[model samples]
Target: MPVTQSDIALAHHLADAAGAVIRGYFRQPAGLEIKEDRSPVTLADREAEAAMRRLIEAERSGDGIVGEEYGTKDGVTNRRWVLDPIDGTHSFTAGRAIFGTLIALVEDGWPVLGVIDQPVQRERWIGVAGRPTTFNGTPVRTRACPQLEGAVMATTSPHYFGEDAALRYLALTAATSGGHNRMTPIYGGDCYNYGLLASGQIDLVCESGLKLHDFAALVPVAEGAGGRMCDWNGDPLTTDSDGHVLAIGDPARVDDVLEALHRVHD
Candidate 1:
């Protein structure tokens, strides 16, 4: 189904609501705690998602919602919203400005629109299905990286990769670097890297253990900007993905990265 202009406007409105809550706690000391998964969660994340939820419930009462801080809210319609109020919570809690609010709309279980809003940086990227991606209302495109040797790669962190996956990721980056010694992949950008890739700043992003909310907003943004984002096996990302994700500015380079990732033992 096609996304209506009203839907796009509501997506931005959701981002604005999330951003307002996030910006209030941007640099101030936040009340933080560790979830059972050992990941950090702060008041900013909780309040921001709540803010978006309030607006969503008020405006689109029939739409479902899935958020990082709060659990699922079943809806009466097929349209659903995925929210990650603070994608880079570690950075956010550390007083870094790399964190952003992620908003994505899934229609019939498929993402049709996405927004990445960096409140501190005042940068926003909006992508809708069958439409050109926009950065602050201006159309944006990805830079070309016909090959891997010169491509800039980014990942949130290797710590999330576990031992076996980390080795494979290193091998893949080695291939991109032309050898094991030539490349140093950038680290710690979180969802910001995907927004950058959509805007053509980064070339490739490979990460493991992403949830629906983690990479959901990135799909439309990447594809809308002339890039491809998929699983490690080149499968389209969805709610059922295995959490291993690959986003490349150049579609031609995917096979090479996948091959390198498989060269190592699992």
Candidate 2:
């Protein structure tokens, strides 16, 4: 089924609710704790996710929900909203404004709509399948970089990658750099990197170990902004993806990026 304008409006509402809760905890995350996986969680993460869930339950009853802090709530319909209240807790708790609230509406295993909202910066990017992405009410487009040669790349952190994957990433950067390109590499941004790519500030992003909420909202945003998003295998993103992701500003460059990931390392 196609994503309705009403659904888009509700997505904004969800982001609004989540952002409201997160903004209150800026610079003062309460009840911070390390999860069993060793990732940090905070009161802002929990409360913001809760707030978004409440709205989904109210406005879009019967829609499923998957959240980072609270886990899953099954629904009768195929559509589910994947929510990550604050994507970068380290940045959030440390008083950085790069953290964001991610909301994705996945219908029949495909993301039909996505929103990345940075409450502190008051920047919101909305992407609906088959529609252009928007940032702060203005349409955004990715910069054209057809090959890895001159592309600017980012990942939240290379530390998030496993040893083998880390080696592959390093090889990819090496391929993009040390040539006439002088390709720039960025270290930290979390979900914000996708937003920046949508707005033409970034060229490519590679990440691993992400869950549904982390990358679901990013797919539509990147694609809607005239880019391509896929797993490292050059396949489209799905609800069950293994979490290895690449977002390239230009569709023509995907093969180059994938080639570097494979050929340079293997």
lDDT of each: 0.89, 0.91
Give the Å error, residue 135, model 2: 0.6
Give TM per candidate.
0.97, 0.97
User: How would you encode candidate 1's per-residue C-alpha lDDT over 1-266 as one tens digit per residue?
Assistant: 68999999998888888788888888897899999988899998999899899999999999999998898999999988999999999999988888788999998777889999999888999999889999999999889887888679999999899888899998888878887565788999898998899988999999999999998899999999999988988898888889999999888888888888988974
CA RMSD (A), model 1: 1.2
TM-score of 2: 0.97
Count of backbone collisions in candidate 1: 0
Clashing pairs in 2: none
- Measured with C-alpha atoms, the lDDT of residue 84 in candidate 2 is 94
Instruction: Determine which window of 10 residues in candidate 2 has minimal summed lDDT.
Output: 175-184
Query: What is the Cα root-mean-square deviation between model 2 and the actual structure?
Result: 1.5
Name model 1 segments beyond 4 Å from true: 180-182
